[model samples]
Target chain A: MLSQLVFGAELAYGTMLYYLVLFLVLVLLIKVFAWKPINKMLNERTQQIVSDIDSAKQKHQEADSLAKQRQDELNKSHDEASTIITNAKQAGQKQQEQIVSDAQSDAQTIKDNAHKSIEQERQDVLANTKNDVANLSIEIASKIIQKELKANDQKALIDSYIEGLGKQNESR
Target chain B: MNDKISTFFLGGLTFNIGNMVAATVAAAIVLVIVVWLSRNLQVRPTSKKQAVLESIIDFSNTTTRGSMSDSDAASFKLYGFVLFVLIFVSNQLGLMLQVDVNGVTYVKSPTADPMFTMTLALFTIALSHYAGVKKLGFGGYFKNTYLEPFVFWFPLALFEEFSNFLTLGLRLFGVIYAGEILLKLVGGLAFSNGIVTIIGLAPIELIWQAFSIFLGAIQAYVFVTLTSVYINGKISAE
Candidate 1:
């Protein structure tokens, strides 16, 4: 009974044709169902990866440029600050020099005015002293002349008396 | 176990129809599964079924590409993959579709039939030559194939052509038919004894069934490999 399963092992032309058709149908179904879709998915994945890398690179370059711009602005502000400080320092120095020169000129003017006033005061004192001394000497000389005049008049009167007595005696 | 595919007389050609019907149904089932599994494929495959299909495609491409250029590999890999999956599945049909009709057991492995495999091999070899002719044109392909190194090689080349289909078909038929026979023998072993037969036959049947699946898959791989080799032979040697 089991040996009947062998069925003589005969090859057939009709079976060959049948299997070929079945095989081709299976091939067609598989091509439609599996091959096209899987390849599409793979291609989409590849494209997504490539575009991601490109965008990332572009963003990195932008960041680098922005950082460079920030650095430039910082440097420009620093230079501007330095220039402002330098200008302020020069203006302070000029103010100090002007103050010093003004003080010196003021002191010189005060000193010259004081010297002129002192010279005028000394001349007034000298004139007052001369007048006082001249007055004092004139007073003393007048006293002396007064006393001498009295004495001389007395002496002259006596001499005149003597002379007149002599002249009268001569005339008589 | 019967190797003869049931047939009917239609018009003039003896239409081989029963196993053809069975095989068509099996192929349709395969088609449905393939379509369903791959319908919503993702770049990053998520489901187990999707992953399994992807792995098969990947392995097929890798192995098939090993022997040929990328372009040829891409084009021919469809046939390779389709043959592998379909034959492998049909070979295992012996496991699933065993049935009794009027006290006779029938298993539905199309590849188990020598004629079926022989026919597939013939088609594959014929297509390979066709591809060769298409690639090199008729005269160039003829000179390249038949008159390669010398005219004296013609007989040997003809022998190679006949032998290619023989080997391709016989190898698969032998393995699958043997597996079916072994399964039958192990089933018979269970009938002869009590403890020893029970334990021994049960384990042997189970292990053989699993191994048979592995064997069937390997045979399918071999079939695809030989087909590609034949195609490469015509494409490259020219």
Candidate 2:
């Protein structure tokens, strides 16, 4: 209940100037209050979104390259393992062939030696049999000559003794 | 109250006129709203208050940029923003508020004053002239704006300046003043102790008040849009 102050409705130059000045002040104040801060915030938001997209792209590319590196490493190890296995297999094959060839050569040498010893033993046995035959012949001839003293009478007695000795020797 | 105007005299050659309290109150209300909305503005702008302020600033920027040259967009936006708030708030002052202190009734739009609207129009023209001068040099601006398109058209161009002032100020004053008077008459009907008050006045007042809001916004937009157009005319050689 304090409305005793009455304002005249006349158009005053001072009042017009007052309003213009007021408008000028209001314009300046609005720039401070809403315009500057709002624009700044909007610019910040735009920059933030752009930077976020940038960082996300960077991270995605990094992940892609890392995955490729991992795949490459896996492939390399896989190839290395297969190569090592192949090399080991080839070495094992060579060792096995060498061992088998050496054993075959040793077996062949032993077989040849046994064959030469058998041939020598057979030749020696034949030579000894011929000598034994010659010795027997000489002993028979000497016995006949020594017994033939009287031609007719001694001939029948020597023949009978020689035949009896031959019979005894054959039985023994 | 034959005329509901309160006049205050200071000391010498200056005096306050045409609802100083109402104008001050309108300005203060806008100031408070602007400050309150500006508080805690965020990059994301979650609050409706912040959203409202952001939209206003954005609209002003876009409108200024669209209507005027790229050079004047920044400075004119400040002028446009302030004018919009002053006119819009003052235009909508009498819708739902009644500030009755003692005997005097303080109701009506501050923009209903011809002096106030004319003052803004004068500023718009002055700023545009200054912009033209700054762009083309004083001699070039004078020649281009007044002396071009034949030598006799200089008087016509001078008359055009007066007309710009007249049209811009009068249009705003006419629309807002009529709206305020209509609201006053309708408001009187509602308070009158009669069956007609209940049956006729209240409903019509409600509908008219609702429509007034839209009218007030349109008037404010028109004022700013015309200001931009006038400024563009003065600055551009065409």
Candidate 3:
């Protein structure tokens, strides 16, 4: 019974063992070779996504700084224009008072002269304020852009500015 | 039914009824899985079902692409999935069904048989040769194979061929055959003793059987994973 049992078991095993080895070898070979390339592509794609995100972030920072500079320039020009308008108003008031005190010229003529000169001064201030704003805005913009010229850094600033413009356009 | 399931000879090797039925069942199960997964696949992969399927495919795809070139790896993705399902199902059959024919019990896992593994290995090896030949002409393929060693050992070329066949067939056969035999031996020993026999008939047998089923599933996965590795090695340079 023992001999028969052993023989039967061996026969069953011998028949199957050959196939198992073959299958293992084939599987091992394919896994090592064919599968590697697919994995490589996945890794490459992941890296590309990361790089894209980094570039986008840099662009945001650059735009943020450019916007800050533009705001400061606008505020400076507004202050200067207000100072000029206040000084002109004070000079016009003084001339009107002097003509009234002298009593040589008609009161209506003095008032008309004061009004005409004030109007002229207002026109001059408008022209100068327009020119000042233009000049000041250009200088601020250039300074903001030139602050950092590293490839990635510069790209960020430009991207930030474009995004700001885009937002403004969307609002309008 | 007999006519439809006729046995065919391949190089004098006999393929019996069990082999035919098992292979058919394995193929059918695989096809079902593919169709089911195909119908449910989503563009964004949000649902749990879609995510589960995509993850397996994605993991395998990433591994394969890393090993081979892009175009070549893309072509081989589905084959890897098919391999996983087929081997798992085939091994599970042994635990699920045990047949007794003429007082001799046959607990056959398709993978436990050397014939099936050998056939699969031979198929892959032949495919590699075909790929090599296609990439490099027939003359080049033979030249590369034989010319690997110092130019004088031409007679050893046949031995090299035989060794490849032997190693591929034996490795899987040894592992699975040993495992199945070990399980049978343990079960047989338990059955022969009165004390063991009493316990075997109780809930322990069911628990043992279930555990065996799990083992079968795991072994099958291992077998298929190894097969893919071998196939990849043969077809690509790296």
Best by DockQ: 1
Worst 10 residues of 3 chain B by lDDT: B1-10
lDDT of 1 by residue, A1-172 (tens): 4323443444455666777877887788788777789778989989989998999999999999999999999999999999999999999999999999999999999998899889888988788667755765676577567665576577765576557556744673
B29 in model 1: Cα distance from truth in Å? 3.3
The digit string of per-residue lDDT tens for model 3 on B72-174 reads 5655565555565556666676666656555333435666655665665566466556656765576766666655555665669658666666666556555
Give the C-alpha miss distance for residue B36 in model 1, angstroms: 1.6
Give every candidate's TM-score on chain A: 0.59, 0.59, 0.40
> What lDDT does the true structure give each of the candidates?
0.77, 0.76, 0.58
lDDT of 2: 0.76
Q: Candidate 2: RMSD over Cα atoms? A: 6.8
Interface C-alpha RMSD after superposing true interface residues, each candidate, one decimal:
2.0, 3.0, 7.5
Estimated TM-score for each candidate: 0.79, 0.78, 0.54
Show model 1 residue runs off by greater than 4 Å.
A1-8, A94-172, B2-5, B15-18, B103-107, B192-196
Angstrom error of the Cα, residue B121, model 2: value is: 2.0
DockQ, all models: 0.44, 0.38, 0.05
- Scored by TM-score, the top model is 1
Q: Provide the lowest-lDDT 10-residue window in model 2 chain B.
A: B11-20
Better of 1 and 3 by TM-score: 1
RMSD of each: 11.1, 6.8, 33.4
